[model samples]
Target chain A: MIDNLLFLAAPITVSIILAGILSYLGNHILTRGIIFVDIAVAQIAALGTMIGLLLGFAEESANVKMISYIFTIAVISIFALTKFKKQVISQEAIIGIIYCLALGTAMLLAERIPGGSNFISKTITGNLLWVTWKSVLSCLIMFILIGIIHVIFRRHFIKISDSKNGLPYSLWKTRAYELLFYITFSMVIVKAVPIGGVFFVFTLLIAPAAAATLFTDSWKKRLIWSWIIGITGAIAGMYLSFTMNISNAPAIVTLLGLIVFLFAFIKLATKRIVSHNLSKEKGS
Target chain B: MTGLEFMFAPLVASLLLIFITVYFGIHVIEREIIFIDIALAQIAALGSAVSLVIKNISGEAAGHDHDSRTLLAYLFCVGAAFLFTILKNKKIRIPLEAVIGIAYAVATTSAVIILDKGAGSDVHIHDMLTGSILWVTWPQIIRLSVVVVLTGGFHYIFRERFRKVTLSYHGVDTGLKNPKLWDFIFYMTFGIVIVEAVNIGGILTIFAFLIIPSSISALFAKRWTTRILIGFLVGGISTLLGLYLSWNMDIPCSPAIILFLGAGLLVAVGLRAINKLFSHQRQSR
Candidate 1:
């Protein structure tokens, strides 16, 4: 039992690290109301990986990594360029279009390459149980570095996401900042996709942040609650995966989904009770 | 079958797919729930995966039972549509789009887990993603048409109510009664169309069919009939180009079509830009 539990340490630790940066970015994405952007970028990065494989590059090689990074950077630049204020077409539509085009192209490539179906499935669902300690440590260092960058630009990032206020910087500077956020965000996605798969990355990014939003209004408290919820969900998911003999990533995602639902339910129940009491007080 | 005979079913299937998907896509864009089709597709995929697992447990090969599997998939999509209706409340703090995104993630991961228990998870996953548009059959085309006609008829009968509910998003109060009821109807119909389209075109092609044409139409027109007309022209042209390219180059039909649609979008964007530039020049004179 101890050995079995020890075997889970790397995956759990990787989940914790991912949950950290993902929850932070999740707050930003949710605030922006472009919630699908992460998955879209993740798909673009996966398409990049497919291109690397098609070029005969090894999956884990630095060259393939660079190729995916380049792909995501190019796509992010397009997203930034397409950011229009007048909103003739919704940004969500643009993101969806990019996602489908990328996915379709990837599917096309996957058809030709040997073992391509296996490779695409691995990228989509991930193999969290087989995560190594070396990858975990490397991801930790990279996430910490990105976390520092976000910390340094927190005010600017936060202000830009505040829809009520005009941008604090000039149009060019704001675009630059937006570019910075997308770059850092895609960097994390390109890394996280290999570890947790696209679905896991999306769940880690959205679930806890969404749950935290249900209970709190302030950013700080929301961040705190998000981390707490994210960590709890990760640990609980790992535990369930071990006991139930299920795959790790889906277990984590399903638990996070449940946690969000539970939070939403609690919020609804409490509001109902409070309103009930208010009606009684008014009658008195 | 030789030549166009081989391509006929897929061509008809794609046209039928465009027929309903483009209509739904316009509504999706109008409502700003752009990713909703993908979300519903994922849910339907999960439902199908569940049926596969059920068949496996019952000591039968998983892929044979089409009727129950499709039914289950439709049921899952409708359930999700119902949930989306509730989550569309204005009082909810989290954006409905976020909720839909979360639903997509959860549904996909759950499908992965369920399919993992089966032997042919990879093939199933690939089929769910890319579909077999080239190998589409006349029967499938017939089924898809029945669904399209039924859904189109439903929308036509209550077009006014459905229009008002979506317009409500822009703060336009047409004073429609029980907008939630109409909203549920709209999403349920949308969900049904997606499941059928996904079966024929795969998720990616169905998405392309739904989004690309409608989006291109939005570039030039505002009225529903005009927009859908342009959408059909754009979708038809891209489908023809894609099928021809796939036939000539021996590539997968669905993704090839999707790429062509994407190219069309690029061309449309360029045209819109050029139009804007010429108008600006005219204004300056």
Candidate 2:
């Protein structure tokens, strides 16, 4: 029993730390109105990883990372177009189309490889439990680096999400800033997807930030609350999965979901009560 | 079966989708609900997952019982549609896209959990997402045709309302208020078509058919009929070309269709670019 605890301790810690970083990114995702970006980018990233493996790059090789990075850039460019930027198509819809395209391309590319399809599922669900200390360490370094970049240049990158409308040209100058953001964003997805999987990464990336946004508008407070929720969700999820003998990633996602809905409901209910009380006071 | 038969059947099904998807695409584009079909499809898949779980719990063999799954899927989709409409309520803090993303995550995770519990392979879910567009069965074609007729008739009758709601300048400026009745009608129609399309074409092919054709058509055409024609033309040619390439290259079929549509769009965009260039030159001259 103690051995199991020893084995899981590293993974659970990794998930919490990862969740914190993801929540920070998640706030940006919520602000940018590009919540599905992580999923779509992750899928494309996975496809790139698959093709890298197909081309005989060792999974951990720089070649695989390079290929995946290039694919992500191409995908970001495709999605950056004014046509896709139109208000006519919901941002999620464009993401969906891009998602389907990447999925199809991956499937077609992987059709002949042995266990290619399993690779696809693994990309989404990730083998969160199997994460090693080395990988966790690397993730830690990357996160700290990214966190520092974010802290130093908060004004530039955060605006991408808050701008709310406009094509890439209208949205930012030099296009360098937006490009940097997507590259940074895609870098996180590529790094995290192998350990956490697309769905888990996405849950970590969106849920805490989403739930926190419901409670307050202050960016700093929202960031703090978001990390708290994310850390809590991760620990709770890991515990649930461990006790229940279920998959860890799904457990984490399901828990995060419940917390999100709980927050939404609370917000909804409080507003209703306040409005009702206001009406009664006015009548009196 | 002959090559012709294989080609003909899928084309018929693709054609049936063209009829419904273009009209719905216009509304979806107008409403900025591009991911609605995916959400609805995922939700429908979740319902099917529930039914499949029930079937497993009852110790039934995993046979393809079409009706029960379809019915369950419909309920799940409409329920999702209702939720989506409600989520569009102004009070929510998240952007609508983020909400759609969350809905997608929850439904998908729920499906995964149910399937994992049932000890089912992921193949079923993967198939639900990618679909076998090439293996279009005859019965499926007939069902889709019926949908085409029903949606076509209803759309013709209520074209004005749909037009006013979907295309009016004011409605576009301020997001269309998805009143319960109109929203229900919208989701119901979208739900029915997606539930059926997923069965035949799979999610990827169905999505490609839904978004790409209409997007290309909208690029140039101003008139509604012209847009519909352009959509049909793009999809038809893409489908035909995809079938031919898939047959020849032995590539997985749906990707072929997607590739062709993608290529077709690029060509359309190129043509538009060239036209603009020529017009610019003429003006400068």
Candidate 3:
């Protein structure tokens, strides 16, 4: 068992790193109320990689990165344009449309390429067991860089996401900050999607933060709780994956999802118990 | 068979899809639970995956057990709908839409985990997304039609109740008797339709069929009947055009349908924008 864990050490470490940073970003996304934006952005970036592969570029080549960057730019532009003041339609509607479009287009392109279905399947669940220590090092470096940028502009990012801040939704400065945020977000997704796959990335990005929200409203406390929940879930998921002989990405996601569901139930039970005590005290 | 004859089954399948999906789409939009269809579809897919996993462990011939998988898928969809109904009254701090979105993510990943235990996970996952509309046969279309007619009859009988429940989203309670009961019925029927729709059209195509036609019709019409009519018109045209393109160009049918619906949505949005601009100018005058 120890030898098996040692063999699995690199993937476990990468998952831990992913859970930490992705949990932070998930908090931001939950606050923003655009929950599926990560899924949309990740799928579109994968589509860009598909485009590169269609043109005969290798998976992790510079040309693939460039194509993904262009797709990111296009998506950012769409988000900015669709952030209207009067809002003829909901932003969620637009996001849904874009997600389907990207997915459909990717499927079309995949049909023409060799091993395209396998490529997509990998993008969805990822190949976490095959990740090497060298790629883990690169992933860590990229996350640190993005983390620093978010830290430097923490206030602006938080304020813009706060819906009741009384600021107009369509300001030029808001657009610029939104663009900055999405650019960095896409950068993380470009890195994370390859490592964790779309499903695992989304789970890490939403589940921990959601669980944290059940216990507190303060952002700092939520971040701390989110990190704790995420790290714990990651370790448990890795253990489960190793012992059960299953794949990593889906196992981690299922564990994290169960954790969030369990937290919600715990919150409900406590609330009920406290209410019951209060009623008894009133009767006395 | 000739090319046009070959395209006929898919065309009937797409039109039959509009018959059920567009109506639920109106209710979905009215309630603004836009992602529910996709979420429910994912849950349904998860259901099939679980059954497949069970079959694998039981050491059976899993490939031939289509009926059990379909039955399990229906159970999952209705069960999710029941869960959503219960959760709505619990009034958790998070938005229901957000909860639905979370369910979507988790269910999708769970399916991934289960399907991985079986062979051909890649092809199965890809088919769940894009679907194989081009290869649909007459038997499938006929089976779908029977369910469609039954669901349509149920809705027609309870039309006023369903409308009342949907309008209650805007706080207009027109004597809704047992709102929870009505809500379940609506969702149960909705879930049933989604299981069949997802089987035929995949996740993306069905979503477009659900949202785009109703959204476009909503841009022009006010009354429920008018909106349904407009939705039918838009969807019918898009299906014909999309299937024609798929037949001639040999692209996948589901995506082609989605792209054409997307194009229709764009045109509708543009027309709405132009209409707004003219009205604003007139107000200024």
| Candidate 2 lDDT by residue in tens digits, B120-160 | 23623565666776787888788888887987798789776
Q: Candidate 3: deviation at residue B133, Å? A: 2.9
Ranking by TM-score: 1, 3, 2
Docking class of 2: medium
CA lDDT, candidate 2, residue A108: 88
lDDT-wise, the better of 1 and 3 is 1
Model 1 regions more than 4 Å off: A164-168, A272-284, B52-63, B115-125
Q: Report the C-alpha lDDT of model 3 over B72-174, residue by residue, as the tens digit.
A: 9899988877766755534344445666777877787667566665222452345577677888888989989998999998999989999998887666858
Candidates' C-alpha lDDT: 0.84, 0.77, 0.80
Per-residue lDDT tens digits for candidate 1, residues A197-255, read 77788888889999998877788998999999898899999999888878888889889
lDDT of candidate 2 over A139-245, digit per residue (tens): 89998888888888788776656755654345436266666667777788888887877778888888899988887888899999999999988998888888987
Q: What lDDT tens digits, residue by residue, belong to model 3 across residues A179-212?
A: 8888888788778887777777888888888888
**Which of the two, 1 or 2, has more TM-score?**
1
- Stretch of 10 with least lDDT, candidate 3 chain B: B117-126
Ranking by lDDT: 1, 3, 2
> What DockQ does each prediction reach against the true complex?
0.63, 0.49, 0.45
Give the share of true interchain contacts found in each model.
Answer: 0.78, 0.47, 0.45
Evaluated on chain A only, model 3 obtains a TM-score of 0.91
Model 2, chain B only, scores a TM-score of 0.87
